[model samples]
Target: MVDTNRITGAAKDIGGKIQGAVGDLTGSKHDSVEGRLREAGGQAENLYGQAKDTVRHAADEAYHYAEDFYEQGGHSLRRGTREVSRQVAEYPLASLVVAGLVGFGLGLLVNASRD
Candidate 1:
């Protein structure tokens, strides 16, 4: 969840930079090619890590929204049932109507808050 690949990618990138710097300082062609290759590989890895992070974030957001919506629906159902039971025991038609209205408003509020 913490994106280990991204961390690894970053380390690779830094290592590549250091290697490239060292190769340049030492004037070694072999080291220079190796360094360039490593740098390219690291850049690719960093791009991949960024894509992965984006996907993970989107998925997490979707999951949270679904969970919140489900919980809100469940709570609304429970409250509605309780209100109906109370209304039935207290006042017949009036309480029923009022309870329904209140429950509806609460449901709307929950939905709005999710948005």
Candidate 2:
């Protein structure tokens, strides 16, 4: 979450540049190799950061979609309940029986799906 790779990459890049400069000044092969390795590490870290950013964006989009679906479902339930209640007012007994049967069937289906 903190994007440590990105931070490390930046640090490595700067460190490599400094080390490479020093190696050049002192004519040291070992220092040159170390510097190149550091630079490679930094580039890898930068790539990782980009990948993390892409994943974060995708997760955010998925969360928004789920939230939208939940909100819409709640609204649909409320509207359906209101309409059903209005219909029930016109015929109490038949509506009650039908509603009970529908609820039982729905419950059974839900339970079956969970299994």
What is the number of backbone collisions in each predicted candidate, taken in the order shown?
0, 0
Candidate 1 segments whose C-alpha is farther than 4 A from its true place: 79-115
> What is the C-alpha lDDT profile of model 1 across 10-75, one tens digit per residue?
788888888888989999877877887887788788789889889999999999999999999999
User: Per-residue lDDT for 1-115 in model 2, tens only?
Assistant: 5477888898998898889878878999789889988988898997898789789989999999999999999999999999988989988999989989999999999999999
Evaluate residue 64 in candidate 1 and report its C-alpha lDDT on the 0 to 100 scale: 100
| TM-score: model 1 vs. ground truth | 0.61
Give the per-residue Cα lDDT of candidate 1 at 90. Answer: 84
What RMSD does each model have against the real structure? Answer: 9.2, 5.2
Give residue 98's lDDT in candidate 1 (0 to 100): 83
lDDT of 2 at 20: 80
Best by TM-score: 2
Task: Candidate 2: list runs displaced more than 4 Å.
Answer: 91-115
- Global lDDT of each candidate: 0.86, 0.90
